[model samples]
Target: MSLELRSVNYPRRISLMRNNKSRLSGFTLWEVLVVLFLMGVLLTSFTPYYGSASKHVRLQMNRANIQRIEGAAQLYKIDVGTYPHSVTDLVYSQKGMSDWQGPYLNEIPSNPFNSEQSYQLDSSGRVNNSSAN
Candidate 1:
């Protein structure tokens, strides 16, 4: 009885291995190629939407930068009884507002389009406008 059981188990194990091997033979070359091609097409189709989203995010950042600068300069203006002598004054001036609380922004805002076009103070020797060209 024991010998018979061993023989049966041995064949059963071999049959299971053969079944696994056959299943692993799996997809045909054409099927694999079709799946890869479909994925490539999907990636290509999604690229433009990703690019647009990225562009929108950057533009939104630029707008936020403008607002931050405007707020800081306005605060400085209120404190000193006038706007800073220059944008650099925002950075260097210790004699700002009495209620003046801040390093206002971390770094000066730069125009996302033209790095050369950072936020500027309209130094007409009067009130500063952060949006001046």
Candidate 2:
């Protein structure tokens, strides 16, 4: 009886291994390449939308910076009794006026649209996002 059991188990194990080998394996190389190509096509289709969103975010950031600079210039005018001649006065300590209590801004920011352009102040101390002219 023991010899018969061993003979049966050996044949069963060989048949199981043959069954596993015959079963369908995972994706083929061609299938993997097709999936990668599809992903690339999907990404390219969304490229224009991503570009527009990025531009919108940049424009909003530029607008916010301009507003902050304007507010700082206004605060400087209120404390010192006159509009500053340039935006630099808001970030730099002016000589001789004890009321000029600022360093209102830690640093001046450059224009986002064109870095070569910088924020400027109009005669009324309003911030302008353009080259000084």
Give the alpha-carbon lDDT of every model: 0.70, 0.84
Worst 10 residues of 2 by lDDT: 124-133
Candidate 2: regions farther than 4 A off: 1-25, 129-133
lDDT of 1 by residue, 1-133 (tens): 9999999899999999999999888798989999999999999999999999988877888777766766778877766666655556666646634655556566676676567865665643232334432
Residue range 1-133, candidate 2, lDDT tens digits: 9999999899999999988877666787899999999999999999999999998887887888778888998899899998888878989977887999888888887777777777888888887535422
What is the alpha-carbon RMSD of candidate 1 to the true structure? 5.5
Cα-based lDDT at residue 119, candidate 2 = 83
Candidate 1 stretches with Cα past 4 Å from truth are: 1-23, 94-102, 114-117, 124-133
